[model samples]
Every structure is written in structure tokens, then in C-alpha cells.
Target: MKIALIAHDKKKEELLDFVSKHKDVFSQHELFATGTTGLRVNERTELPIHRFKSGPLGGDQEIGARIANQELDAVFFFRDPLTAQPHEPDVSALIRLGDVYRIPMATNIGMAQILIHAIRRNEF
Candidate 1:
């Protein structure tokens, strides 16, 4: 399965920790992420990930395009809802596209854990 990993600035560390904890599970699949997030995950986990541009610079749109084309199987987006984002519209569009395509997505750590477990069990 192709899995996308994304995190807002404040949530990057949390996402990284989650990914690290699940590195064994994640290592079995293809991973994709936005620029800084991807770089950090790769550096910390040594997981090979395809990196897109920074979200404000079009990464969310890039991921959304994949969702539209049915290329991604799941998305793990650790969004920081309390903060204002400059690319809020793009983020909304990406989430909308995920729903439109019926792709499974997790916007928080709890949901992400469930999704990852589901993937492991071949529930999807």
C-alpha cells in the first residue's frame, strides 16, 4: 500500500514519534510525505520516502492529485487545527478529495494508529 505522511509545523515531532514507533509496519510499504516532514522522517527513521514540495508550496495539492487518481491507499495527516495555516484552502481541498475518492485518511494520532492496524490486518 502507498501511505502518505504529513504533519503541520507544531505536530511534526508527534508524527515523527508515531512513525518511529511503527517503523516496522511502515517499512513494508511505500511512503510519501511533504518536504520538511519527509526530510525529518527519513532522517530519523531511515525510511525511504518520496518527498513533495512544502505544503504551502503545493505539497497538499500534489498528494490530492494522487488521491484523485486513486494512487494513494491511505493518508496520515497530523494537522494542527489550533493554528492558522496560510494554505488552509489547499488543506481543505486535499481532505475533500480524499473523501471524494473514498480514501482512508487519519488527521490525528489515534485515527492513524487505527488505520495502520487495519492495514496490518488487511482490513482495507
Candidate 2:
């Protein structure tokens, strides 16, 4: 399965920690992520991830395109709802595309845990 990992600035650490905790599970699949988030995760966990542009710089749209093409199996986006994003529309579009494609997505740690477990069980 192809999975994407994304997170807002304030939530990057949380996302990183979650990824670290699930590294064993995640290592079995192909990974993709936005620029800074990808860099940080790779730096810490040494996971080989395909990196896209920064979210504000078109990463979300790139991932959305993949969703439209049915290339991605799941998305783990740790959005910071309390903060204002400069490219809010792109984020919304990505979420909408995920829904349209019926892709599994987790915007928080709890949901992410479920998705990871599902993956572990070969449910996808």
C-alpha cells in the first residue's frame, strides 16, 4: 500500500512520534510526504520516503492528484485546525478528493492508529 504522511508546523513533532512508534508497520509499505515533514521524518527514522513540495507550495495538490488517479491507498494528515493556513483551499481540496476517491484518511492520532492496525492486519 502507498501511504502519505503530512502534518502542519505545530503538529510535526506529534506526527513524527507517531511514525516512529509505528516504524515497523510503516516499513513494509511505500511512503510519501511533503517536503519539510518528509525531511524531518527521514532524518529521525531513516525511512525512505518520496518527498513532494512543501504543503503550501503544492504538495497537497500533488497528493490530491494521486488520490484522483487512485494511486494512494491511505493518507495520514495531521492538520492543525486551530491555526490559520495560508493555503487552506489546497488542504480542503485534498480532503475532498480523498472523500471522492473513498480513500482512508486519518487527520489525528487516534484515527491513524486504527488505519495502521488495519494495515497491519492486511485489511487494505
Candidate 2 residues 1-124, lDDT tens each? 9999999999999999999999999899999999999999999999999999999999999999999999999999999999999999999999999999999999999999999999999987
Lowest summed lDDT window (length 10), candidate 1: 115-124
For all predicted structures, in order, the TM-scores are 0.98, 0.98
Alpha carbon lDDT of each predicted model = 0.96, 0.96
What global local distance difference test value does model 1 have?
A: 0.96
Off by over 4 Å in 1: none
**Per-residue lDDT over 1-124 for candidate 1, one digit per residue giving the tens place of the 0 to 100 score:** 9999999999999999999999998999999999999999999999999999999999999999999999999999999999999999999999999999999999999999999899888898
lDDT of 2: 0.96
- Clashes per candidate, residues 3 or more apart or on different chains: 0, 0
